[model samples]
Target chain A: MKLTESLSFRNIKGRPVRTAVLIALTAIMAMSAICGSLAVMSLRNGLGALEARLGADIMTVPASAVSKQDFENIVLQGSKGYFYMDRSYYDKIAEREGIEKISYQLYLASASAGCCSVPLQIIGYDPDTDFTVSPWIRKSAGGELKELDVVVGNDLSVFVGETITFYGVTCNVKAKLDKTGNDLDTAVYTDIGTIKRLIAASLELGMNDFKDIDPDKVVSCVLIKVADGYSVDEVLNDLNLHVRRTKSFKTTDMISGVSESLAGVSGIIGILMAAVWVLVLVILFLAVYMSVNERKKEFAVLRVAGASRSRLAGIVMSETLIITITGAVIGIFLGLLMILPFNGLIEESTGLPFLLPDTLHIIICAFVALAASVIAGMLSSLGSAKRISRIDTGVILRGDN
Target chain B: MTITATGVCKDFIRQGKNTNKLTAVSPTDITIEAGKLYVLMGRSGSGKTTLLNMLAGLLTPSSGKVLCDGEDIYALDDEKLSRFRCEHIGVIPQGQTAVHSLNVLENICLSYMLYGSLKEREAAYPAARELMRKLGIAGLENEMPSALSGGELRRVAIARAMLRKPDVLFADEPTCDLDDENTALVLQTLKETAQSSTAVFVVTHERDAVGYADICLNMSGGSIGKQ
Candidate 1:
């Protein structure tokens, strides 16, 4: 038998309640660890995928009119906003020799009565010329997007065909687009003309502040794509000189910001996981220490009967290992449960653009938890074990006392 | 089979207000030999068990050496000394030290295994069964010590100690809780074990057990004089 099996069979078998408690404690710690790990890994992967797909390069906004402290924040802070694109800057970019084709797209967060309890985002574009749809968009309708006709993304399609009142006018879901497993999946693609009409109508209905949008003029942000020949710096400089109050940013910067935020979240998660381990170990140490103290005389008897201190220590350590291993296995299963439900949440929050964690991450995490638990058990038992194993039998067995 | 204890002193400092050092046991010199049944008789505070423990290698002397077969047991490192004790010495405590979780057969088997004679089962088990049968508690092999009567527990404890076939066997209060008839039976059991290559050391103040020993050494006032 392994040291663990023997120790458990001999020692733990005697105390049913204690053994159960130790296992439960270890399992709970492991579960917390797994939950923390899942959160970190998912958030990181999601943000990374977002950055990669969006080509997170540098961006330029209308240089802050505010002081240097808030200078960067002036244009950047309003994370999701729409401003008019200056036609004059577009003319300058075309006139520059090295500069290549320039395209622009508008954005909107659209919602309608749907199966989901939350509002969804809708993006409108001129499929033929929009820079954001320059290459990847494959129009499943066999022709370019038209006025009032919306090509529903995979996510939107579920609630798309059914009438969703947008600005009090019902629209049709012309066709369902392919899944991108990204923010695109949550978006509804239609002609820019339809969006402009919606903005005009909502304003007519007297809705002004966003949830109540003046649909007549509502365009949240404009996505501008620079051609391969012209560097982003050149375009940014030109736009800064020509357009006032209109922010010109490469798509890259926005995506990078999302990725950085995820990194910060992952760091916090890791710290929480570590704290759980330490807490669990402290609990284990107390339990084992008290139990060993109760059996002091028993250890004395064994020592007198010719058990070397090392052998006795081994027995004590083995008892802990056995308890920790049992608890860790249960904890891993619990940990997995903790991480599982959040898989869909991660996918939704990050737009499902990143790779889902496979069995490998789960298995590796479980093994690590088990190993840490066993080490914790050993550390917790150290003090009591020394006292018992090195018992001074001479004093205990003397009849004079 | 010679065991020697020389110039032994032991002091116990009880924890309390105005703490005092109480000298419990002080012995000059003593020797034990093969085939001898020695009895140590003492009053409640006479230090009889302390002397017995010193001889059994369970306790180290405050300032002296206990040599068994020319080697000071205390001088030996833990493993070597423990091995010597496991193989060469056997002790029967006052109450049942027979592990309660194990049945009779397992307890007897454990004694043989612990003393490093696991393969010598034919010599250990049959002897255990014959001893049990002679003690009149023959068929209680599977019964736990908690379930057994005082006499039965004592008999089983003796059976385990004797099964190891050690060079020396020490018993403390072997017949304290037994009637005359049972005492005689236990004494006979001791005599049979002593017939083999072993020395019998009994520590008790009981008159009946002391009367039957080959050597009776009376103890009083923290010293063993003569019988």
Candidate 2:
């Protein structure tokens, strides 16, 4: 070791209690910064994925089959539920003047059956007409979903080529979607033919929600994209006015509520981070100040032994750097352990989308957290270093107060 | 190098109701020449320590200039003056002054480590070991300050001060904590250091230190006079 490093290590080792406390304080600072930033970033990434996934400009659902809130809960909160409307609504919506393109999906809530560990929200889309879920599915599954082939959400424990029976109908898992950090992560997706088979199987078991409804002629909801030059509100009004026994609304309206909730959550996280930083900064400053005061005589001896004022300051800063860096690495590692392994728990608890950023983004966050901790260490120690460096060597050595 | 203090004095403000100023050392002139051992003897509370501090560049006098080899040390900024002290002055402060964290060998070589390059500091180990051997603490190099007795620590300080072969060396109460045998050993080392062409200044209440001095001085009421 260099002389300064050896000296700093000895000084740190000489006072075990003080050094531990300072290190603990820095650790807490770094931990909070990393955890808080990762949480906020994950929520943002999840929300962005959700917005992109909800590709339709407007949607129509059966008025008596599902409440608007319940439909939103199924889509946004990943709640396990299903509803059906007559397939004729899809034709009516397609005939509307402002409707540019239209598609409909069927939803089936599955019971805990073969290879399934829990109840799941099963979404069946028409591969021929889909504009939203198809693009995402192809990105992962690499091809069109075939008969009896299932593309599972990221959160499912099932893997590719694994066969899972829903309502006694067997299907092979084609691919697993990437995480959306929402209820979608827990959902299963399949093509229209497989969904009809599952529905027929459920009907034979007397487990279907609407026993009288025809499985082949029913859809859960109709998704529509407004043509250019037509406002979404105008088409939405036209659909509600002309369509019967159905509710029509803009998709943005649903997302706006989610956006508000996200804003509130982000605000609270920001406030918490600010509070932690301010409190830690003050405590760190005082800790450094008191440590210098306690070691005043030692510094005076260094002065008497020909250490310059700046040299004394350098010694103190070096010690601070060592402590802060050690604390930062430990804290960041702990944060990664907590967040990466239990992201589902966090998403459920916060009721917010919690997709972790890509590897590059995570590395950036770590660097930012490390920088914050080191800067805090340096800033807190600066005053103490200056004070000790400028101490009256003669008086201190003479044991004067 | 010779150090000369001209019209130097120190006054500290008494921190009480009146904010009255107390003069610690009166305005006086003194010159320290190389190759001599000068002992400043006085009672407790005499200004001997303050005068020694001014001459060693550790303390700035409230008035007048302290010149070393024709350059005013007090006129130089803290950086230059501290470097000057590191290069030419070595002070063994009064009382226990070890940097408790470092072991004996590290403490002894602290002067060289302060401003020397890594290679230069490494090269100083041999000289430091020689000083430790002469001071009778050769085998205690790895011991901490807390593990040593009062006199051993004093020898360590002496070894540290002499490590640089400084042009001027100041020993404050160098034998205050020693028995007769150790006291004789320390005073003889200072006297021998002086004979080798390094100026040595010592402040003490021990009369035994007087015999080792080439020139003895006395301080009373913040003023100095030849004894």
Candidate 3:
């Protein structure tokens, strides 16, 4: 008899109710794994798009602090002459060999009322070369730079067509940008000259906000974009070394540093999922082991019928492959069905986009599950098949009868 | 051809205590001609079943060699010995146990398919159909083993054992659980199959089976024929 034929017949022999229960468990394991994996993929994709859109590719802030600290500190600490960047140096570095382009925007705000009047970041950029603000600016302005006009980001768009006073100067929102689902969505965009005028005017009038403003301040910090072939780390190292020579110029004080939390989140999820996979492995092991235990008589009969050890093991493995593979395929299908309906909702909430599993993931998952099932079945059958092989058939006949 | 065994001893450490070393048919030589019906009668735990197992190549004797056509079966390795039994010897264990998954027809068909020559198998269906008809189980061929009664199952088991036209047949209690009618029918089938030059060895406590035997070996004292 063919090894597969026997195994197939055996796998299907149990009562319908019993078989269904076992298959359902396998399906759950498969579906749960796929769901977890897809969640990871969706989140990572969202975070990636967000990161690329954010101006923080590498923030230049005081080296001691990371994250929002640089933006906030540069605003708070005025006379300390610390956290300061000469905004004019941005244009000079834009001409550097390895640098692509630089963007510098000063956050300008004025106290209005309550929480609704939170200090807004005012982004300033050169019209021709800025890719950083181009997305939001294009959306809000309806066109490229028209001198003196300003664009607002998504969060600020609710106040569209409304004018807000800051430092006693009123700037009307010319247009509102589509939501990028990031902090930039809350900021305002204008040209470099417009922000410089606001800061200078505020300082000259000695407005409460302008009393602490640095008159000689050029740009808070330059946004450095390295050319395609040049390394950012190498450029930063060179720039820092050159900038450190001046007593008042603090290269370390200006650079914010790299953020690794996104990568860290992915790693943590991976470890947690691995632990879950180990538990699934244990379940798989038990299922295979139990099937072997139940089929002791069958294995013994086949062995006495002269089946070799390898062929007997083949029988067990064939059954496992059928079960595991069938379960996994059904699982992916069920998982897709489960996640797809809520896909848009998740994307909306998490700021992440999701993609359907492709043919490659299906093929690879099938191959992996099959291999795992076969190996697990082979291992589980070891003791039972051995016992069958060594059974004294004459005694079994006597005892059994 | 006939099977012969001399000075066979088999030991067993039964139940972790009893050192039951069975010297079944020990130093006793017997042979029956081809195409004969033979019976061994014994009580429970007697060595008659063990002796039949050795003849069927299911067990190895401690000392003696079982020769069929002058070839010692025990000398062959496990696979070769199993192949020999599959081709040349048939066995019916105690109780009319059936391979329950396969229906009556498939059960008989599989037995012949395992041992029949390729050409013989090409014509197997007709032969099996004829056997079923003769045994009055032709209509039950599609029924699973569990659906059959004790008597019906015994007839089916006998049909399966005789499927390959083996040279030697070993049956343990072929009619043990059958009524008078089924038992007689079973003996009649054995007698008919023996016409093809197959020597049938039957182990039973019942005398009805002994009446069909050309020779009787009564096993006692872990030996055969009372010395």
Candidate 4:
């Protein structure tokens, strides 16, 4: 070590309590800043992915399901829910003037037994007409899904060539979809024919609530894309005015609620980060200032020993740099431990999609946080450095204040 | 080496309400010549320390000049003057003083370390050990300053001041915390340093210190005169 570094190190080691306090304060500041930024960025990324995955302008669900809020629970939270309207609704929606395309899906919630630990939301879409799930399936599965073949979400523990059973029917896992950072990752998807067989098996086992329901005659929901030059709101109004025993709403309306929750969460985190930074910076400033003042005689003695003013300042800054850099690295590592492993828990608690940003983004955020913490430490000690450098060596060494 | 101060005086502005400037030292001329022990005797606040500080290059006089080897020390900037002091001047201030974190040996070797002289540091240990042995602090080199008693700390300061073998050495109350045996030992070391051609100036209240002096001066009411 250089002489200045050795001196600074000894100064830090001499005051254990003060050193620990400064390190801890900077650690908290770094943790809050990094975790807060990651959380906000992940949420926005998850929301964006969800919007692209929806792949529809509007959705129509059974009036009963809408009234009971079951459709929201199923789609937004991946809760185990199955509500059906007549398959004729697909034809009815296709006949609407502003309708550009239409498709139907059947939802079947599986019991949390057999190969699954948690209940899975199984969605079956018509292979011939699906614009949303099929495109993703082609990307992951590489081709059309054969009979009894299933595509699993990223959160599923099952891998390709594995089989998951639902209601005594075993299905092959063809591929796994990428993460959407929401409850959608907990779902399973298949073609309409396979879901119909599962529905029939469920009905026979007395696992279904609707006893008279026929799988071939019912659809859980209808997804529609409006034609170009036609207003989505206008078409939505026409559906609600003409359709019977069902309700249609814009897909954006459902997303807005999630967006609002995300905004609230992000704001709370931002406020918390700001408050921690301000408090840490203030305490650091006062701590450094008071510490230098208390050591006036030591500095004066150093001056008597022929230390220049700038060298004295250099010693203080070196100590500050060591503490801040150490604290920032520790805090960032702890943040990764907390956020990376428990992302699902965070999503569950916040009820918001929580996808982590890409690797480069995370790395950049950590570096920025590290730099900010070091800057804060240096800035806080700047005043004290200047004050100590300019001490009146003669008066102080003479025992005059 | 010799330090010459001509028409040197100092004034401090008393802080707080009813503030006024007070002269700490009166304009005076003095020369500290090599190979002599000069003892300055005075009561507390008699400006003995102030004058000592000016000669040590630690304080700037309000008027006139202090020259060491034909260069005005006060005229140099902080960098140049501090380097000058490091190479030529050594000071032992009043009361206990140490870089508290460093051990006794490290404190004694601080003169070389402050200037980052790697070669000097390589040679400082043997020289420091010699000084510590002479001051009867040989076994305490590894101990911290806080672990030593007041007298031991005073000896450590003396050892540190002499480590660089500087041209001019100043001590304020160098024997304030020592027993008779240690006090004699310290005074003898100062006299020896003078005999070896370094100018040694001591500010003290002890009458015993006068016995070791080649020249004795007294200060009263901010003015200096021969004792």
Q: How does each model score on lDDT? A: 0.65, 0.85, 0.61, 0.87
Is 2 or 4 the stronger prediction by lDDT? Answer: 4
Model 3 docking category: incorrect
Worst lDDT run of 10 residues, candidate 1 chain B, spans B109-118
Query: Model 2: what is its DockQ?
Result: 0.53
Ranking by lDDT: 4, 2, 1, 3
Put down candidate 3 lDDT per residue, A206-234, tens digits, no spaces. Answer: 55565555534655555666678877667
Encode model 1's per-residue lDDT on A322-359: one tens digit a residue: 78788888888877775676565565554324334567
Q: What does candidate 4's lDDT look like per residue over A268-364, in tens digits? A: 9999999999999999999888888888888887888889989888878888888888888888888878898999999878878889998999999
True contacts kept of each: 0.23, 0.63, 0.17, 0.68
lDDT of 2 by residue, B1-227 (tens): 89899999998887774668878899989888999999999877778888899899988999978999999998888888888888899998888778888888889888766776667777888888888888888899888899999889888888888888899999999988889988999999999999999999999999998899999999998999999
Error of 1 at B23 (Å): 2.9
The reply for model 3, stretches above 4 Å from the true place, is A1-7, A10-15, A29-295, A298-313, A335-362, B15-33, B112-123
- TM-score of candidate 2 versus the correct structure, residues matched by position: 0.91
| Model 4 residue B27 lDDT score | 97
**Chain A TM value for model 4:** 0.94
Candidates sorted on DockQ, descending: 4, 2, 1, 3
Evaluated on CA atoms against the true complex, candidate 1 attains a DockQ of: 0.24
Best by DockQ: 4
| Interface DockQ per candidate | 0.24, 0.53, 0.18, 0.63
Q: List clashing residue pairs in candidate 2.
A: A78-A183
**lDDT tens digits by residue: candidate 3, B64-166:** 7789888888898776776777677777777655655566776665544334444554467677778888877778888888889987887777777777677
lDDT, residue B63, model 4? 95
Each model's iRMS: 3.8, 2.3, 4.1, 2.1
Candidate 3 chain A weakest ten by summed lDDT: A73-82
State in Å the error of residue B117, model 3.
12
